[model samples]
Target chain A: MIETKDLRFRYSDTLPFVLEGLNVTIKRGSFVAILGHNGSGKSTFAKHLNAILLPSGGKVLVDGMDTVDEDRLYDIRQHVGMVFQNPDNQIVATLVEEDVAFGPENLGVPQKEIRVRVDEALRAVGMYDFRDRATYQLSGGQKQRVAIAGIIAMRPRCVVLDEPTAMLDPVGRREVMRAIHDMNRTLGITVVLITHHMNEAVDADRVLVIDHGKLLLDGTPREVFSQAETLYRADLAVPQPVELIYALRRDGVDIPGDVLTVDECAEALYHLLKSRTNTRG
Target chain B: MLKDISLGQYIPGTSVIHRMDPRLKIVLTLAYIVVLFMAKGPLSYGLVLLTLGLIIVLSRIGVRFVLRSVRPLLFIILFTAVLNMFHVDGDVLWSWWILKITRQGIETAIYMALRIAMLISGTFVLLNYTTSPIMLTDGIEQLLGPLKRIHVPVHELAMMMTIALRFIPTLIEETDKIMSAQKARGADFETGNVIRRAKALIPMLVPLFVSAFRRADELAVAMECRCYRGSEGRTRLRTLKLQGLDYVAIAIAAVLAAGIITLGVVLP
Candidate 1:
């Protein structure tokens, strides 16, 4: 669990605030996605969850431990893991299993336990088969999965991923998203995903849309995306399915506007066509 | 094409030598070097060569692969041998203008070349070809643990080395990408004099440096998020424990060193 209270941050005294008087809370075992355009401070917010970047003006508490407390830094980090965007940069080891073990090792876990955690984490990410493979030899999806495994090996209660799938291909994105969801569901770990991808946020229990260092919209995928005009004004787009529903509605097709997934969109269209056929018959 | 260059000389295997504790291997390699330099005569050199031969065979890495490690240094070895052969004055077996090919000179040349070659081949087979780079750094870190009392940042240095080794291939891939991008934009890297070619690299180097710095920054944050706060209170997954094979290897190294030293004194 993470709680941020009017959190504000700036890189330096001269620079303007990147995050300004923003408040957000991430519940334990919940999947939350923060959506924003580039430089909208979503990553800055993710970093705050794990104390990678301490708030300049307000408080960030990881399960009741303050991020500003120097002594609880490792404790806070262990409770909330952060996965960065670049798979190549985040992996500290040359080998897959070794990199996964890095986080557990840093936490001072016993050698045997570290091994167990590494294997378990790799398996959770569907990368158990590639445990001994060289990190560079892996595909983009596999590498991102390995990065996720590295974080979960520490057995953190929460994970904050900053645009993890931004650099990945479509297939790689799917692979990483599946791994993230597996951790959230099977492992019961809280997941805070930061991304600009509308589809990535579509499945989240809650989506917080950020704009210019402030919370612009906060609701479920359907609620956040239904306000398509506002999201567009913030230089963001709805998921393609939601966009399609909105487009049809604009053409006076009288369709539901809450479709967030392709399946839902297809079902709506199918029912609409079936009703039309019945009327004609 | 650059990706084909193996970053480290390690050839992965499950051979006895590969399974040896890297700390013991490092110590034995150092001891072997000492004995190698102490070698004086043909008998001593022969013993040294025999020890290296035994290690190469035990490594299961093949003699050819072990010898390949010596290829890059062939020029230096030949240069040293030639210098020693011409400079050493002894019984002249042949005469040239100012260069006399003496029996002792020839013997010295052969011994010098043999020592250098065996030295490299022994380490390559015993250490590089067997131990992974991570294990090698781990061994160095533990071996230098005592130096921490003297205010040495041994863990940090080893950590830096480990990270550097990890990023080498990634950086190489980036370099390949940058080179291709430049080539696509009509940047000529192939044809020119040495200086011209060097100048052409400026474009590639600038972006490479920028990207490398960005990666470094992101990596630091990632490492911090993983709770990596230097080596303090850290545990390792693969702890270096000496096994029976390691002790046997150590005993062999000790015997080889003592035998070579004794042979040098006895035969001299």
Candidate 2:
């Protein structure tokens, strides 16, 4: 569980605030998708969750510990792990299993326990077979999964991934999302996925949109994507299906504008046509 | 072609030699080098050869693989053999203008040649052909652990070594991508003089350096977020605990070294 209240941050006094007066709470065991255009403070907000960058203004609490407390830094990090954008950058160890075990080793976990956690984490990400393989030998998707496994090995209560799939191919993106969703479903680990991909947010339990360091919108995928005008103003777009439905509605066709998936859009069309045929008969 | 280059020459196996502690393997390999040089007559060299041969067989890395590791030393081995065959003076086997091959010289040539081959093969058996680079670095770190008391920063050095080794392949791949991209843009790296080719690389080098720095910065942040305080209290997932076989291997190595020195004094 993570809670941020009136969070304000900036690189220096000369620069404008990157994140200003942001307030949000991420519940335990829930998947949250933070959607925003580039430089909208989604990533800056994610950093505050694990105390990577202390707030210049307000408070960030992980579970109950404040991020500003120097002594609780390690505890805060252990509770909330972060995966950055570049997979190649984050992997510190040559071997996959060793990289996964990196976090636990840093926490000073015993060797035997670390071994167990490494195996479990790798398996959870579907990368158990590549445990002995070199990190460089893996593809982009596999590398990102290994990064995820590295975070999960820390046994964090929550995970914040900063545009993790931005650099990945479509298949790699799916693999990483599957791994993240699996962690949330099975391990009950709270997940905050910071991404601009509207389709990626479709599967989340909730979505928070940020615009110019301000909280623009917050709701479920249906509620968020339905506000196409608001997202467009923020320089973001709705998922394709939602956009298509919204377009159809504007063209004088009666259809649901809140549809988030292709399947849902197709089913809605089928019902509309079937009802029309019945009325004509 | 660069992509095919393997970083470590580790041949994966479950052999007893493979399972030996890397620290012990490193010490024993150094000790074996000393023993090879101390060997004097046929008996001592024969003992040294036997020990090294046994290790080679136990490592299960194959004789050809070990022999391949000696390929780079061929010129040196030949030069030593050729020099020792004619330079050392004793009973004359043959004589030519400024080149006399003596019976003593012939014996010395064969001995020196064998010593060089055995010395090189001993390294292959204990190191390159068997141990992974990371494990070899780990071994070095543990062996140098005492140096930390003398303000050596051994752990940090080893961590740097491992990190460097880890990034080599990643960086190579990035280089290959950049080279291809530049080539597509009419950046001719080939068909140029030495300086011209070097100059052509400036474009690739600039972007590569910039990206590498950015990666390093992000990696540092990621490492910190994982609670990496330093090497002070960090535990290892694969701690090198000395097994029973390691003790046996160390004892055998000590005996072999002592036997070689004693035989050097005793044998004619």
Candidate 3:
């Protein structure tokens, strides 16, 4: 589990705080989506999780290890992997397999075992076939998957992705989302995904919304998306189907606003229409 | 036009030279260059030219392509040839005001041009046309690995080199995109005076620099997150090992250099 206590941070003494007095807890092996707009401090919060940035006035503890402890810096990082935006920038090596081997090689893993981990990580991300290909030649989505493979090759207990799909196209976005979901479900690796995309957060076990450097909301996807006004105040929008249901409920249609997916919305509408016709008969 | 710069361009092949270890290739290329400078008289030059020609043919990197590699150096060759043609004093063949051409001048000019051309093509054949840049850097790092005893940071330098090579194409593509965008905005990069045009590039440079710095920061964080401390206990996927072909290539280079030096003493 990861926990932050009264987390506070700012760039300098004179600047306004980017994050202030924030506290949250994340369970082990759970997929959580951090929701926020640009400059809402989501990325800053994610950085503090792995001790990439220490809080100015608070503390972060990852799995009972204090992030501020100097000796446990590498220990904390090894447990929490990070994948950043810009797939082109995060890739360190020219070759796919070599990039995947980077993390393990850094940890002093044996040469033979490093190969095994690299192959496994590539397979996990569904990029084993392109193991020998040059990384620069790959599409954005494939490159992002290779980055994920690099992180997983270290065999971390948790992974944090900071807007990993923001630079990708629609197809690439879906491909990356699929890989993240697979990593969470199959490997049971705790995932902290930082994204503003509403649809991407729908499947997450929990969602934490940040607004003006404060935790504005925290709940499951269904519970969180139900609060349309709060998301509006945060400069965010509800998922499409939830928006539709909210509009219907405003028109006195008695539809629930908790629907997070299109299929659920369709099923609820089908039942609503059926009841109305039976009452007329 | 910028894309025409052929840097570290490796053409994959199955030639005997291509199959040699990259370290051996580098050492041999340096030896061949030293010998080319030592060569003198018609006999040594003839032997050096004959050897280079045979190696070119054997490497299978066509004569036309090798000559094309020399195309960019045309200006330097012309300058050297022209300077040599009129500088050497001997029996005058032609004289006009400050310019004088002699028989010895003509001979020296021809020899100088041939020497420069042979030097460039020899290095190109070994470095650019055959061995890949990654292999070259790997060989360099291995050759310099012992310098770490003196605290030289060999691994860090090699890693930086590899990363730089990897990002060149990416940065080029980015520059192309930024240029087109600026052009579409009627930024007028072409029709301005030198200073004005350079100032016009400020817009492009600013964004590129910003992105570059951002990329460097994020890459540092990502690398640290991956447990990269230094070269302390790091291992590599591809290890450099010298083969029998490498030994033979080195031997050939040594023999050629010794022959050239010996011929320099005996001839003329």
Candidate 4:
């Protein structure tokens, strides 16, 4: 489990923070999505997860080991691996297989094991074919997958992707999100997806809303979308189906349901139309 | 690795030098250097210079690139000339108080300058213009393959050299970015005293060094990830092969050197 208590971080004490008084807990093996508008302290909160940014006050722990402690730093990092926004910055190796093996190698894994892990990670991420290819030649989606494979090879219990799909195109974004969903479902690895896209967060198990450096709301995606006022107050938005349902209900349609998924919304609409047909007949 | 250092600085061309086998090119360069020292007076030096200039022209590399390569050594050239200017004791052609200009001094200065320029330009033709560093180092390693019997780490050294060459541009690019970023943070590297300027570079240098170390660490991890376990049984993807043209080229260069050496000494 990842836990943050009263996590207040500032670049310098003389200045105010982009993250303040943030208290959050992430359950193990759960897909958690953190959503907030720009300048609402979501990115700053994301950096604090892997001890990339140390908290000025309070504490952060990855599997009971405090991030504030120096000896537990690498362990914390290994446990809670981070994939940065820019795919270019995170990838250190020219070759795909080598890039995948980076984190495990840093932990001093033997060459044979590293080979196995590299191959496993590449195959897992569906980038096994591009193992020997020059990273410069890889497309943006391929590059981001390579970066994810790099993090995956480390065997982190929790993978924190900080807007990994932001730089990608529509196709690239879908490809990356599918990969993330597959990793979460198949590997059972807990994923903390920090994104600005509401639709991306729709399928997640839990949603946490941050605004002005504080936790504003936390619940399941459906439960959270049920409360429309909170998201609006936080300057955040809901998924497409939820937004459509809310708009229809606000337009005097007697839709008394919270719709998170497209299929769920369609089913709800079918029921409403059927009832209307019976009443008219 | 840094990508802009021009270490893999091969300019693709259909010139004779570019087409020559790398190993043969290495052998020819060594032989040429040896012959260059044998160059005695005006006739031999003139032949060497003319031959190099011809090759440079054929290579189609810009004069500016060659000049840029030599620019770093300008101080050394000037120093050697200045030293020879004062130190060479010979026929005193003229004297202006302590600044005496001798006939032999003038000739020695010109010869030294010409020798330095010819040596650099010729090698630059082989290295910077014609062949890439990776190929060059590979050629050197292959040529020195026999040293493996004597327990020389020729492969390892060659690998190290290639990596160093590869990272030159990467590091330069990193440094450029760091400088720009630090400048954005209002760090002034220009318009300061020597100490102040040095102090101002702390932010830039710190980040650059951090990034370099980070890259090195990451590269090491990546290499280990790829199952790289030193110079034991690695095979080359692009093995070097010598063609008939390579032998003919080397033979031609050998004969040219021989003819020049013979005519310079015996005829003189």
Best by DockQ: 1
Clashing pairs in 3: none
**TM-score top scorer:** 1
**Which scores better on DockQ, 2 or 4?**
2
Q: Is candidate 2 or candidate 3 better by DockQ?
A: 2
**Model 2 fnat value:** 0.87
Task: Give the best candidate by lDDT.
Answer: 2
TM-score of 3: 0.92
TM-score of each: 0.96, 0.95, 0.92, 0.60
Worst 10 residues of 4 chain B by lDDT: B220-229
**lDDT by residue (tens digit), candidate 3, B59-105:** 89999889988999999998999999999999999999999999999
Native A-B contacts reproduced, model 3: 0.74
Q: What are the DockQ scores of the candidates, in order? A: 0.86, 0.80, 0.68, 0.07
Candidate 2 docking classification: high
Q: Cα lDDT of model 3 overall?
A: 0.89
Decide which is better by DockQ, 1 or 3.
Answer: 1
Chain B TM-scores, listed for every candidate in order, come to 0.96, 0.92, 0.92, 0.84
What lDDT tens digits, residue by residue, belong to model 3 across residues A171-241?
Answer: 99998999999999899999999999999999999999998899999999989999987898889988999
CAPRI tier for the interface of model 1: high
Model 1's alpha-carbon lDDT is 0.90
| lDDT (tens digit, per residue) of candidate 2 on B144-183 | 9999899999988998898988888888889999999999
